[model samples]
Target: MEDRKQALVSRLLQYALIHEVLGIPYNEIVIKRTFEGKPYLECSKVGVEFPNFNFNVSHHGDYVAIASEPLCLVGVDVVCCTEPEKEPVPEFIENFSSYFSSLEWDNIINTGTSDEILVDFYRYWCLKEAFVKAVGSGLAYGVDKVEFHHTNWTNISVKVDGEPLTEWRFWLFKLPERHWVAVARGHPRFATENYKRTICKAEFDAEEYHKGLNLPNVAFVTRIIEQLIPVSHGEERPTMQDICSDCLHLSSREA
Candidate 1:
């Protein structure tokens, strides 16, 4: 019940954000999920037209994050760095070791003290989550196949099956509250094509996404629950589809 409640809250926040960004009325904002359960707006059904505008929502600990862009697909994740309560860090991380590449696991374990290791582990986890979310993959996505390559945790790029994905971009930011946030942005068609069995036949303007690379480094401004509440609900709720019509119906294949 608690998990459902939080999910509802996050869903409402997503609706509220779209209202604020695109100037759509709260009652007119329509949201639906992909077969993989990634939320998106069906612009045509919603009476709006924009080229490949996409957004994603995530919440963890005390923060909820949303990343949206018209040029590229975007995913955001927030992870709170907290010590394990039931087991040591190594043990806890071991349970998830299968999700990481051998190289990534080596980097995590070799990193400095226990606290630093915990942070590093969460960083990798956060990045993985962000990438999957960006690509609209659900729980079945093979996180192990997509590996993030970084030098000293900087200059983030991703590789799938040992080949580099040059068009995708990643960024990680540390908050003052021992929390880490990661963002993943990639060309919409490229993002979809890379997903096994998924196809994007629509002509794309890759140049637009690249030209916008001059986009300023965005900083998260805190929005308390109260400030968000007003937009979270509206007098009349619009009908929404359970699954997005615009999303491809491709089934996920194992890596």
Candidate 2:
């Protein structure tokens, strides 16, 4: 499972960095790991600094997710919405509730239904993971230190180290099915509403190397590649409606 997870994440990263971000083929990009084991692109190969390019990858259950931003730090996470087959929902929530803050626990209980509770659990879990990954500490930072308050699904407030943080924002939405995705990014470059989420379901033929890999049916990856390059609007300035017209068209298809 670990090997398969790494391979899938690498494939997604390659596609995202080479085709999406760099506008180059996969062969031209060189990837290196940081001292902390985080993967980053070797910008010198492209003859550009690429100081603003940042990305993060995560996989849980059957899903793998990747997020990238041209000029801001970005982190993303995806998780299955159902509990493990070995444990029931009540028992699973009881076991994991201690890891969440008091308000998070209350939010779960207020969900009222078992299915709703399960979804909420994964929602909070993904958000916490995304935030930690955005900070570049990964799990070593301990998710318990941060708390999330969601006034609504899209509107959220984060408190880390017992203080409110205004420079960060989060987005929570469902993919196609059976999964939830969350994103965390820095301020000024992108707003919460500007972030677009989509479900990309693509199959990679790994039968030659790995016979059985548990790949998810739905993958939640960002569409930030389109934002990296500037679009030319002949003479006249493009309206915000003209920019996000495609997004608005796809909004109806989102789950």
- Global lDDT of each candidate: 0.69, 0.58
Single out the weakest 10-residue window by summed lDDT for candidate 2. Answer: 193-202
Measured by lDDT, the strongest candidate is 1
lDDT by residue (tens digit), candidate 1, 77-165: 88889899999988988999989999999999999888888999999988988888887874457889878889877899998878998
Q: Candidate 2: misplaced stretches above 4 Å?
A: 1-6, 45-50, 187-255
Q: What lDDT does candidate 1 reach at residue 65?
A: 74
Using TM-score, give the best candidate's number: 1
- TM-score, predicted candidate 1 vs. hidden true structure: 0.81
Give each prediction's root-mean-square deviation over alpha carbons: 5.6, 15.9
Error at 97, model 2, angstroms = 2.6
Clashing pairs in model 1, backbone N/Cα/C closer than 3 A: none
| TM-score, prediction 2 | 0.66
- The residue-level lDDT of candidate 2 at 55 comes to 69
Tell me how candidate 2 scores on lDDT.
Answer: 0.58
